[model samples]
Target: MESPFWDMMGMLGIYAPLALGAIGSILGCSAGGQAACGAMLDVESGYGRLVGLSALPSSQTIYGIVVMLSLNRTIEIESAPGLFAIGSLCGVALLFSGWFQGKCCASAIHATKSKPEIFGLSAAPAAIVEGFAVFAFIFALILAGSLPAATGGV
Candidate 1:
């Protein structure tokens, strides 16, 4: 029972993704709630597109989680430790991306609710949120791209 193995197990494993998922879900849900409420208030404005956009924030979070699982599928336990660190960092980015995206969506909805006259203006800020998601996705791809074949002999 070597301690290095245990230390590695604790540092660059499922814990990262689990934390990421939890953070993403909590923040994303809060943002979604705000967006949904705002959209609900603007029932007659035809800004229904915003309602759909509310879910966009969770895209990166979901993608991050999938990437983490996929990496586990592809990478063997014997691979370099650096891969794990990179993957963990990517997961963190994804979590933040989703949280912020949701925030933008919620703000957009709020804007629409307050002034149905400026739905277009509201969309601009929402795009910023999308930018973060894109950044997170690209980072995840970079981290996951270097993975080796699964050690479980998948």
Candidate 2:
């Protein structure tokens, strides 16, 4: 392959974590937002609460952005594969967590809309999903630190 292509690959490895995470966040937010909208339609009150609930899934994207910033540095061919492995794994983990969190949030929104008393309790599942995301973020940071600093060359 051309040298530039290889360079791009290396760059992709470093960027994948943030990109995938953002994708997951987008999906998660969409799911929750849709559910929130539906819930609001069913209830005359608590429109503000439902809208606030929809934002729960957006935190994953912010986490991803933080990871991306921390992982930022020159890309070297020698370390590219390692970066790719770590970033992609982290990205996948975050993605699933974020997506499921959204699903859980949607369920919570639905359940709480019916029983306002259970609103806090209903968020447990989503909180669990967020915990998993935090785990992924922490581990990714730890793993990323182990990778060699880029030599900034092919």
lDDT of 1 by residue, 11-113 (tens): 5653465467557757875786766766786576565566676766656656666656655543344453545675677667767766876777777777777
> Model 2 over residues 125-148: C-alpha lDDT tens digits?
888889999998888888777888
Looking at model 2, report the run of 10 residues with the lowest lDDT sum: 1-10
Model 2 residue 18 distance off true place after TM-score fit, in angstroms: 1.4
Per-model TM values vs. the true structure: 0.70, 0.90
